[model samples]
Target: MTETKEWFESWFDSPYHGMLYQRRDEHEASAFIDKLFAWLQPAAASSVLDIACGDGRHAAYMKNYVHEVIGIDLSEQRIQKAQKLAKENLAFYKQDMRNVFRLNYFDYAFNFFTSFGYFQHYRDNVIAADSFAKSLKPGGRLMIDYMNVDRVKDQLVAEEVVEVEGICFNIHRKSENGKIIKTIQFKDASGKPYSFEEVVSEFRLPDFKELFERCGLQLITTFGDYELNPFNVEVSPRLIMIFEKH
Candidate 1:
């Protein structure tokens, strides 16, 4: 059987994807969320929306701070697992980022862990921005954690092989047409082969400002890493941005 869906539609749903990036677990998520909450000092009554909340790890931890938290992701498998973590004020849904889950509902919206820039179409990216802004209240805020385009381009490993749980994944990377492309090839225990491709747009700060501004989201602050350090174009591994809804 040949896989024909869009790369994200197929790749993100794969059990292997979860295995490959398993280290992005609750501990890592909680660390970053703690740093973020310390800086933001959000109100105890604030409501949160976690966009692309894979497995609801971040959203589950977030409920400890905010009044309530809703998490949404496009992957059904991920969302199913995330749903098990739901509680009175925590909920998970299989949802797309390009569509509004709630209008003017949340005090804060979080897009974390380099989740943006997945759509190959620039228009689709803009649509996602619109949804992000619309999900927040007028005085609400948005936090986006992404990879620093400059650093990723400079430090990209052209090729590598990683074995996790005895499954060997051969990875290749390249930059093309304003996007970073990663190709992952691997085989299962049964000797079945699989391949997956990941494409993320090379979105710089200026690019985000343009796309978000059009959706009434104003950039407020920018950080370079999980520690909330000032962004350095040449050095930062992560591009963490905060925006306010207008």
Candidate 2:
């Protein structure tokens, strides 16, 4: 837990941070969010909660469909950006999602784009899951979008480098103990570099199913991708799981 916290906080102070909702990946993110909302079918009056909601892109998108939206992230800078773009009934908070939070307030909750599984200790993941469960109203639904470990393993790219917005980044990945550990190095235009390694621990399908059950939720659906395709060993690029509080 300490390692994960330090790694994330280091990036929180940098401008080249919060890859999830930052503008660089907006198109891909919006496509995924469209599919998520279509499947969830949230009502206009439903209150939605987004855990680890980076820059609150999904929460902003949800404003068109829901009565209220709340996004929470650990990075204060990202939350401030979210708040600046907030509209009526949309808000953002900066807080650790693994602690006891204001309870039973949301009609639906979502954690998208492999946002879960950063904890160094297994108990930390459990604590975060419990916090998510407690944040929802009875019978509320939760959606978690994560990389399909099974599929990612099949297509593991040992190392790759790419340039986005004139910033060079390198990605290295390996699979161990049914988990993927990735190291990302970001270099500014001037060639100054900073690297962070993240271990996404024990996040295969069966592991997540067990966690959901232990948190008092029933698995409702598991899809291979954001498009809601049936999961198959050779076909899926992502894992999208839906759960309902029992």
Candidate 3:
């Protein structure tokens, strides 16, 4: 597929994507990883892969626990920004998730903060899941942090305006075609208008189970939040799934 065909391809590589989500930087990543490591107790000698590791914040934090850490993202700009931190036992690469990387190499794989479900096609989603499975060793583990679909649909704000660095981002959201669609419109300092849309599939647990099982990943456990609370269909804010490769 061509890069231009996907919404994430353009927006994720753009400066606005970073600006709007600047608050989700290392501080948040560190907090989550701290909790994750404490609970999971991953081996210190394990190899880790951070999929869709925007700017390598999570991978950088995770390097403290693992032997080797590799971060990958489709965005060239993000990979370039992340590459500065590459060193012994840590590295960054530009890669598309639909394409497998370092087959059967990593002991652990992570897809954090709703990184999946960006593809518009079900086949593509399956391909991405297969890629994840292919990238891991037979007994490797994978963690995916996602939003609780029911909770998100219940609590979604229809519209909002966010001002960041002198730009007013007018946002609209709605669920249609089995996906949550968000539209962001803003103007630059020079009054240049720009618009972007984020579309993600509102996949529920069964959807994920089927998607992963087809790709050789078995669900292990699930959490509802960063603190690792039990999941609630109506109340939980996050759907964090842990899987193991067969």
Candidate 4:
């Protein structure tokens, strides 16, 4: 069948996407969350929001720290799977990040693992940021973990092929017109071929600062990585930012 839908909507729902990223480190993710909790030290019964909570891995672990957790993702398949882990302290919903989510209801919000910046337009990104900000109460914080665009551009791999569980994925990456684009091509076990593209805006700190300020969020701090080291534009593997609602 010919494909016409937006890339993320189709790609993220594919079972192959999960398989390709199966090596994502759970221990590392948990450690990062633990460090965040140690630093933020939210109240024992604080309400937490996990934006783009794929498969609810981080959100599930969050139950150990926060009073309650709401995990939302654009992918219905992922949400359906994540729903199985929901308890009194945790819940999952399929939601678009651009829409308001229970305004002023959360004490802390998280957008982790470079999950953002998939939209084609800059305005959509701003809208998503605004939605996240509106979801938080005054004095609430939102933590965003994204790739260091400078570092990624400096070390961009033009092309590669990776095989996972007998499925071969041909990957191509490039920077064009202030955006980083990735194209993935692969075939299923039955020999059916498919292709998908991922587009991320080249959003730097200044871009984010502008968006946050417009949304009434004050930039609190920036970290280089999950361990919360100081951000270095030239060397940081990750750009971790914290913003507070004033």
Which ranges of candidate 1 are over 4 A from the true structure?
A: 1-4
- Work out how many backbone clashes candidate 2 has: 0
lDDT of 3 by residue, 105-155 (tens): 999999999999999988999999999999999999999999999999998
The global Cα lDDT (0 to 1) of model 4 is: 0.93
Q: State residue 177's C-alpha deviation in candidate 4, in Å.
A: 1.4
Q: Give model 4's TM-score versus the native structure.
A: 0.97
lDDT of each: 0.93, 0.81, 0.92, 0.93
Error of 2 at 195 (Å): 1.8
Evaluated at residue 85, the lDDT of candidate 1 is 97
Candidate 2 lDDT trough over 10 residues, lowest sum:
16-25
TM-score list, all predictions: 0.97, 0.89, 0.97, 0.97
**Global local distance difference test of model 3:** 0.92
Candidate 1 per-residue lDDT, tens place, 1-246, comes to 994566899998999998998865566667889999999999999999999998888899999998999999999999999999998989999999999999999999999988999886789899999999999999899999999999999999999999999999999999999999999999899999999999999999999999999999999999998889999999999999999998
Per-residue lDDT of candidate 4, residues 56-142 (tens digit): 989999989888999999999999999999999799999999998899999999999988988877888889999999999999999
Pairs of residues at least 3 apart in sequence or in different chains that clash in candidate 3: none
Residue pairs with backbone atoms closer than 3 Å in model 1 (clashes): none
> Residue-wise lDDT of candidate 2 within 140-234, one digit each (tens)?
99998888777778888999986767776788989877568878888666777778776786587788889988999888888887667887656
